[model samples]
Target: MGAVDRYLQEQHIDRYAFLPFSACRILQPHKLRNCGEVKTVLLLLTPYYDGDAADRNLSLYAVPRDYHLFFRELFAGLREAFALDHPGASFHAFADSSPIDEVDAAAKAGLGLFGDNRMLIEERYGPFVFIGEVLTDADIPCESGEVRECEHCGRCACSHEVCLSSLTQKKGELSGEEKAALRNHPLVWGCDDCLLACPHAKNVEKTPIPFFKTDKQYRLTHEMLENMDEEAFSSRAYSWRKRETVLRNLSLHGE
Candidate 1:
């Protein structure tokens, strides 16, 4: 089947878009242009917003399974399929660990552009989606999709003066003032308030079905983290520091 059918069946994706990227060419030189070369770009889309399911705790992204783990496995499965078809071909799936610039590559492939909010925007999924791509030697297909721009959005300046990503990764312990930032940080692992403030995202369909239809609400509760020991807490999401770190952040956030 083609990339379209593959995305639909394999991914169980009701909604998706494919954008071909020239990441290999960007990385390689002028000489080895086509010498036994094979490569294709694959983009996967996942929705992570749950409406009205409020905990008022934990960052938006870390509420679910580790995306790095999920993306790595999914990309590996894709490469395995490629190897089966091409036999002697060599292939590998690059998670975020790759040196290639992912957001830039995706935008070049016609996925979308990075808005002033510093997030990729598409007509359907907006900015709440995680992007993963596969690099290979087998030549795949490409298409010209919509070019969505984010220049006019003033929310980034008016709001989100501080980035949530930087907030959580804020080194060691926190003081009175630093803890306040964590509470109003918008998210723990990542932030989407800029997207949430988008007028475009407001009118789009409400995450369709199973995307929002899950009892499998990925969330990290205070109680869940409170009981965990140093090792156990570290095993889960948002446990980036000693137990004191989360407690301090939480205490400040709750206040």
Candidate 2:
């Protein structure tokens, strides 16, 4: 095992893969400013599902605090360790705001199969894991794998325009038809309709990470939204749209 693998194991992060930069599809080259000549991509999977996430007004992923914050702290430590190991090597970490197509990279690395819903589905964590990566100039050994596809159950397929999760984050006023769709939508932040219909997502193991297990807000009520300040809103996954978006969703649902 390499230093990176040892560090990940110590951190209890078991799902990870190493691939050559040539295999990755760089979507945002502008994001890689100082990271010169990336030679390797280290893809990681951080599972957040804790089990039985029912009766939540937010998506299972959003029930916990914003994962971006978690990744920031995690990557800081990782980068520091890498810097110490290989002097002059550049290491950059990214989560949702990634330079490469993370899902595609993860699939190519053999971390999981591409689900029909366009999510990476690990056998244990299913599609509930967050994809993060560490891009480096160090020449790491690449894993031998290929892009694999899921069973394609065809249950989670839906148009992007009509997706309740997408509509909730959409800015400005919604159309009458869109309003009707969200009237009885379970979550005010993100939709789990697709995950709920996925067979592979059934009875998955709970996350061992304590950060996700504690300080969770499964149900964000109208009262909570009304009382939320900037600090509280910014700390959550659904905070990107601000409190107004959630409040509007709740009101439309007559909650």
Candidate 3:
């Protein structure tokens, strides 16, 4: 492995698998061979904590700036920077999405430890973080090491409760079982019980940059959605999903 690749592997990729919450994935040289040769995986960290995020109107990811837009520009800059030095290879960026398992890739990258709740927890933000990856055809370095395990800590009781995001995503009236989960659930939007439960969340140092700070917190309130158009609503970290989905989630609260 080259020096650049070695440094990233030891520092970031190495922690991918260990974190209870992280985005873990590998770029297939073969996959990129078709494109350019699959070189480096550009990794990014987005902090979603604001010191106070409970009983919020939106999911944890939603309250912040739309990461999809934020990171696209970020990764593009990285590629441009790398291209200046190593113009021999090409790259691709992905903040990924709900449909893909980003946390799992973080684990594989050795960037953090994994919790039983299936989230990747880092030493700084715990599991309340967003990740982006850039797959490249240039050979750099890889963090193939395994992450330390954090599966059985049982320290945080958030995941055990019914999750609000799950309920809301269902897009309809919740069943008695689902409602029970919500009453006992830790959050109304994205799940944070597991995040709050992690030991590393409280005292981590803040990033020097301001872009990583999320929206602080924003719930999918009825008034906000009812009054605004989809274009406006889509601007938030909250994905531009349909209004009915959020409405059903709010219904669980009977408000």
Select the stronger candidate by TM-score from 2 and 3: 2
lDDT of 1 by residue, 2-116 (tens): 5445734665444334445444335433323433443566665555554534654555455544456556556666666656665655554555555355565666566666676
| Each prediction's RMSD to truth | 4.8, 1.7, 5.8
What would the per-residue lDDT of candidate 2 be over residues 193-225, giving only the tens digit for each residue? 788789988888888887788889888888888
Q: lDDT per prediction?
A: 0.56, 0.85, 0.57
Candidates in order, TM-scores: namely 0.73, 0.94, 0.73
Question: Best candidate, TM-score-wise?
Answer: 2
Q: Candidate 3: where are CA atoms >4 Å away? A: 1-36, 53-55, 98-101, 108-110, 156-163, 183-186, 206-208, 212-216
Native RMSD of candidate 1 (Å): 4.8
TM-score of 1: 0.73
TM-score of predicted structure 3: 0.73
Q: Which candidate is the best by lDDT?
A: 2
Which pairs clash in the backbone of model 2? none
